[model samples]
Target: MGKKLFIPGPIDVRKEVLEKMSTPMIGHRGGDASTLQKSISEKLQKLFYTDSTILLSTSSGTGLMEGSIRCSTLKKAAIFSSGAFGDRWYKMAIANNVPADLFKVEDGKAIDIEMVEKVLSTGEYDVITITHNETSTGVRNPIEEIGDIIKKYDDIIYCVDAVSSAGGIKIEVDKIGIDICVTSVQKALGLPPGMSICTFSQRAIERAKQISHRGIYFDLLAMYEYILKKDYQYPSTPSLSHMFALDFQLDEILKEGLDNRFKRHEDMANLVRDWSRKHFEIFTDENHLSNTLTVIKNTKGINVSNLNKKLQERGYQIANGYGDLKEKTFRISHMGDYTLDDINELLDNIEDILGLLNKVY
Candidate 1:
């Protein structure tokens, strides 16, 4: 039996989603391509809750993250990070020669409004990036509160990395005043990886036009103009496989009903939270736990590697701690097509292993 993935991403793709990737190839510049891409763009606009034009990339979500900040920022950037992925945004900025500063809260803590306001009010910064969900520490930043905070400063561009939380959680892009919002296919979208999709606003377009050296390939303005001219076709060749699956998987997601899907994720998260509380403690604060995954503190200090080995034999797999949190924490994902029954079964198996280890040999 294939081991079920409870990892943050490249999460267990549904059988139908997997098959969509095998769809026969198509011409990227042909009329058929326009029809396919245009259809996907329209659906994505509804998914993102915005009227802004959709921008699709042939790379991971990181590509858009790099492009958005580099292309649109006229001055320095203040990147607010709560965990590892959040830290990456700051690193991406510096690597691209963008003047940037990272303001981070302690691990396992969410970024607060006070820190955000302090940084933005400095008057030295013109752009800001917030990781909506930081997978490393299992913290989902309060984007609604943060978005409200950002809107107060009209000149500061608001960008969000919703990579792990977008489809699993509800994010209203236009209502939140997010100028650029990015996400990929693998996580809660229940599809295979390879491409990323983001929303681009008119204000962001104007900023990109002012920035001259925005690098090749990731140049946001070049992409937006091409799509506007070609009617949703990307400048370079696109990933038809990922796009095909995305179109189909989105249909499945919408058919399931957005509210129902969010509720399913909530119910599964609650089940894991209850289980984690019973056996191990949750790593992040209760107020900001992620709806898609739970990072459990190794309260008992068991050998996590051995535990995973046993889990594999039971036909399931979860993620070990990331970065500096290694061995100190373990993550169990309840995202994608996974159900409540799957969570219960996985927990029962974990209970059996914990019981055996507790027994005196």
Candidate 2:
């Protein structure tokens, strides 16, 4: 059996969901494909808590991140960063030649709401992007509170990268005043990697129309118009395999009930957080700990790679720290289809491997 995955992305996929990926191919331009896309969109809209149009991409969440910044930023974008992924958004802006500025906080800290207010108060930006969850440091920004700050600026288009937290945490997109919210199937959605999804608001569409040079393939306005004109079909051929699995998995997710699924994630996260506190130390601020993953500081100076090796031998695997935090910190994901029982099993294995079974808290 494959080692149980506890990483951020590419988390363990359900057996039933994997089977759906092989449900035969369909003509990408046909009615069946349109119907499938339409179905997925509707379910996603419910998941996202928004009335905005849903857009699908065959690329990872980064594709739509680059697209959103490129297409919506008519003047300049105020990109906020609390960790690695947030820094990636700024890089996307630079790569796309979109005028932008990065507002960053120290690692493991949450973005100060007042800093965002200060940036927007300058009236130097027409767009803003926030990473709702930073898996790198296990920090979950208070976007709802940030949304309140952004709502005061009607002209500022707010975009959020919910790549790691969407399905696991509750995000009321419309109520939060987010014009663009991006996520992928690989994280908390309990599906394999390859496809990305986003909510595209009319305000974002209007902003895209104002920008003349929105890049081709990832252009939001173009994709939005094509879907409407073509009756829910994309301009490019999509991954029919991922669509099949996503369509089936989304149903399972809805059937499980949104509230119940969210509670499961919260329960798992709490379990891990408590374990981390008892053993090592949580890397991120306690006030903004992620509901999907926990980044634990290597306070004991234990060999993380060796621990993971031992874990793999025991049919379980967790993630080492990301980027510069590697070895200094490690992560344990509680997202996707993982339950409280699953978390207990993984922690039990870690304790055995690290010989922490009787270590006093």
Candidate 3:
């Protein structure tokens, strides 16, 4: 019943995007569906800044995360973690019987590039998973710089989880040499959950061809082969509604101007960071804070759950800390279609609920 969503995902969908989702569904394999899929793919290629093929998944971003690790990993994978989502990728790897070793940094910090270099130097891994933005810790890894290092090994595939940063921030997929870049509709894309998008390089497709155990539902090789025959449509019934919304949403995003959108997110993130510094400590590394979300350390010892309950009563929502960090911190997301005015209102509400009118910035 809230007018806004300040949580990490399923952010406030614009009225236009919501309306597009309501358009009448067409047969998934028909001309209409192919047109919709082809259009979205082309637009997404622009968003990703790559000429590589874009793949659509009816499931969430995690589905493609799993698929990327499953399909592209030939010998082994080096899973890098900055927070919970990165850890989830490793979990998916083990669950699918994909051999992988996890590398994680301390909480609130990103994995060092030197560490990544050291690990990759061992030549034990053919695939690597990196999170562009860790929503849990509010840390944005330096993927471009890291990608430069990873690219030298042509045989190695680098898969990036950009679920929370793709549209809100600029990710030059080709420049970064990302073999597989995965994202979803709910976060920075400013659409509802249910649809996911990924850009896959030809190198990744070739690797998938060598792997016999890549699951059917998420087989990148199958997706590649089927789309070659059809007009960029999926093997199964695609979510036409999500595609409709995405087609429209991508237009709005491009019109808004990618640089301007990135600037807006950066501006809002700076505002929140300044506010957090004056009030409480930021959970993530200051140098690598995420543009889409801010995690504030609960230094003031306020009851975050109670505060959120009060916030809900006021028709607003914010996320409490995640995993082991719960109650120690709270997150406020700046992604989606939200503006600075929206964030100011949310902060005002939080200040009022905490009785920190004087304490809060």
Candidate 4:
């Protein structure tokens, strides 16, 4: 059997979902494909709690991230970053020559709301980007609170990268006034990596219309218009395999119930968080801890690589900390279809390998 995954993403897809990926392919422009796309869009709208147009790209979540900022940022952008992925938005802006500035906080901390307010009050930015969940630091930003601040600026387009939290956490997209929210199926959506999806607001489309030179392949306005013009068909040939699996998995998600799914993720997160506090220390801010994954401080100074090797022997695997945090911390993902029982089993294995079975909390 494959090692049960506890890493952040491409998190163990359900066998049924994997099977759907292999179903016979459909013609890209056929009516069957349009039906599939339409069904997926409707289900995603429910998942996202928004009536905004849903766009699909046969690329990773970063593809839409790049598109959203590039297409909508007419003036300068205020990129508020709390971790690595947040930093990436700023990089995408510069690479696309979108003219932007980056506002960052210390690692393991959520973006400061007051800092965002101070920057937006400057009236220098027409667009703003926030990362709802930062896996590198295990900090889930208070997007709802930040959204309230953004609501005060009517002209500023609000975009969020909910890559790791969209399916697992409760984000009321419309209620929060987010114009563009991006996520991939590989993470909480419980499918293999290939395609990404997002909700594009009318406000964003209007903003995109004001900008020129929005790149062709990843252009949000073009994609949205193409779908409306061609009956939910995309501008380019799409990934039918991923689309097949996503349609089936989204139904499964709805069958399980959104509230139940969110609660399961929270329960699994709490299980791992409590375990981390007892065995080591939680790396990110306690108040802003991620509901999808927990990053643990390596206070014990154990060899993470060796620990993972031992876990592989026992048929389980978890992630080490990302980037510079590697070895200084470790991560335990409870997103996707993993249950509390699964979290317990992985923790039990870690305790056995570390000889902490009899140790008192």
Residues 67-110 of candidate 2 have per-residue lDDT tens digits of 99998898899999999999999999999889999999999999
lDDT against the true structure, each candidate: 0.89, 0.94, 0.90, 0.94
Q: In candidate 3, what are the lDDT values of residues 98-167, reduced to their tens digit?
A: 9999999998898799999999999999999999999889999999889988977888999999999999
Quote the lDDT for 79 in model 3: 95
Looking at model 2, which ten-residue stretch has the lowest summed lDDT?
352-361
Q: State the displacement of the C-alpha of residue 237, model 1, in Å, after optimal TM-score superposition.
A: 0.7
Model 1, position 26, has a per-residue lDDT of 92
Residue 342, candidate 3: how far off, in angstroms?
Answer: 0.6
Which candidate, 3 or 4, has the higher lDDT?
Answer: 4
Cα lDDT for residue 93, model 4?
97
Give the range of the ten consecutive residues with the poorest summed lDDT in model 1.
Answer: 352-361
Residue 356, model 4: lDDT of 81
Q: Which run of 10 residues does model 3 get worst, by summed lDDT? A: 352-361
- Candidate 1's C-alpha runs over 4 A off are 356-361
Residue pairs in candidate 2 whose N, alpha carbon or C atoms collide under 3 angstroms: none
How well is each residue in 277-361 modelled by candidate 4, as lDDT tens digits?
8889999999999999899999989999999999999988899989999999999989999888888999999999998877652
